[model samples]
Target: MKCVKTQDAVGHVLCHDITQIIKDVKKGTAFRKGHIVTEEDIPVLLSLGKDNLYIWEKTEGILHENEAAEYLRDICMNENMIQSEVKEGKIELIAEIDGLLKIDVDKLRAVNSLGEMMIATRHTNTTVKKGDKLVGTRIIPLLIEQEKMEKAKEVAGDRPILSLIPFKKKKVGIVTTGNEVFYGRIKDTFGPVVAEKVKEFGADVIGQTIVNDDIEKITKAVEEFIEQGADMVLCTGGMSVDPDDKTPGAIKNTGARIVSYGAPVLPGAMMLLAYYEKDGRELPIVGLPGCVMYAKRTVFDLVLPRLMADDMVTSDDLAGLGLGGLCLSCDICTFPNCGFGKGV
Candidate 1:
């Protein structure tokens, strides 16, 4: 690209977008790249403080910003995603469906580490609605060395650095355990709350079993749910360390592999996570704490999306939650969008 006086730019093609900013009124591209500068455009360019303009001048082994951005987009785009038209030398990726957004963090970091270009994205492993902006790609300079973008592709490897995993329609079972609720002293509120949450992810609560504090009965309820073809089982209440809290013990009796009995998160420290395998299928059996019934958001909210997407959670995954696990319980909750349970 060659720089020329704005007054002498007539008939020259713009190498980049000309942005016009008017405090609160507007801030957008006034003239797009490749636009042939006309005599009437000089006053508009000068008003925007553009005394000099870069004219498009194709050169070998050099890439325009728009071309570089497309290469960056290729590194990040994957299934269930769509890219916006290159605007002002930037390309944005949008979600094509409601699903969990997965970012190849290591590769993403490496790509960004290559100076002069970047791929900014929303947090990985989070849920995104259809049409949501997933990532933005652009080069810092209006032009870049083609070799630099080639190096970026090599660092990203063969696979794209981002993906969207659609949530599965699941059949869920709920085991409401507590002597008080089992005896009909109080209505089972936990079941409804858990049911509502699972419904948000398109899961159907096939059944809810009310069991007392008996370990055997609690274990039987969980096993019965699996036998009924439940893809996931949720055992709510009785997750504390108290003598009567048999939910944890019952989950163990089902012979499920316990991923973690505790998580480093508030309002859910006592939660239990396990997977029960049967006939070659491993189904999740989660023991939720009492907080899930009342708290607006907890560890349950963070982990449910992964479960619905069939993404297995490991002990290390739970351990990493310590960084952003605390929930402030604000008067007006904006969970999932907030920092609660967003660690790692």
Candidate 2:
């Protein structure tokens, strides 16, 4: 591209978009890339504080910003994503379905570190609805060296950096364990909260079983749910180490392989995760902590979406939550949009 004074750019073509800002009124493109600069456009461009303009000049071994953005998009886009048209050297990727957004963090960092181009995405492993913007690809300048983009592609390798795992419609069962609730000494508030949360992700609660703090009864309830074709079982309450809290032991007695008995998170440090193998499938059995009953957001909120998506959670994944695990508990809660559970 070549730079020329706006007055002398009559017959030249614009190589980049010129933005016009009208403060509170409007802010948009005044002259788009590939538009021929007509005599009538000169005054408009000058009015927008454009004394000079960069005109398109075809050159080999170089790419325009919009073209470079496509390369960045190719490195990041995968299945279940819709790519938006390039606008002002930028392209956005949107979710095509309500699902989990997975980003290759290392690859994202590597590409952004290469300079001249960038791919910014939402936090990985978070739930996103259809039509939500997932990532944006931008080229820093009007033109970029083809070699830099090639390096980014090489770093990204064969696999795209971003992917969306569609959420599965799961059949869930809730076991509300507590002597207080089972005997009607107190209302079973935990069961309702878990049910509402499960319903939010399109999972149907097969049933809620209120059982006393008995390991055998809790274990039997979980087994019964599994036998009834429940994809996941949630045991609410009695997760702490108190003598009366038998949810963890009951889950263990169900013969499920325990993934993690505790997490580093504050509100839900006593949470337990296990998987039961039945009929050639591994079904999740989660022992939700007490915080899940009263807290607005807890470790349950972090892992439930993943379970709804059938995404396996490991001990390491739980450990990583330590970094962003503390919920601020703001007056107006904006969960998932906040930094809680957005760990490294």
Writing each residue's lDDT as its tens digit, candidate 1 over 1-344 gives 78999999998779778899999999999998867789999999999999999997878998878778889998999999999998656999999999999889999999999899888888878999999999988888877899999999999999999999999999999999999998999999899999999999999899999999999999999999999999999999899999999999999999999999999999799889999999898899999999999888989988999999999899999998898999999999887788886665
Against the reference, the lDDT scores of all candidates come to 0.91, 0.91
On residues 1-344, what C-alpha lDDT tens digit does candidate 2 reach at each position? 78989999997769878899998999998788866789999889999999999898768878878778889889988999989988667999999999999889999999999998878899999999999999988998877899888999999999999989988999999999998898999988898999999999999899999999999999999999999999999999898899889999999998899999999887899999999999898999999998998999999999999999889999999999999999888899998899999986
Q: Give candidate 2 misplaced runs (Cα > 4 Å).
A: 2-29, 32-54
Model 1: residues with Cα > 4 Å off, grouped in runs? 3-13, 16-54
Taking every candidate in turn, the Cα RMSD to the unseen true structure, in Å, is 3.7, 3.6
Cα error, candidate 1, residue 180 (Å) = 0.9
What clash pairs does model 2 have?
A: none
In model 1, residue pairs whose N, Cα or C atoms come closer than 3 Å (at least 3 residues apart or on different chains), thus clashing, are none
For each predicted model, how many residue pairs clash, with residues at least 3 apart or on different chains?
0, 0
Q: Point out the worst 10-residue segment of candidate 1 by lDDT.
A: 335-344
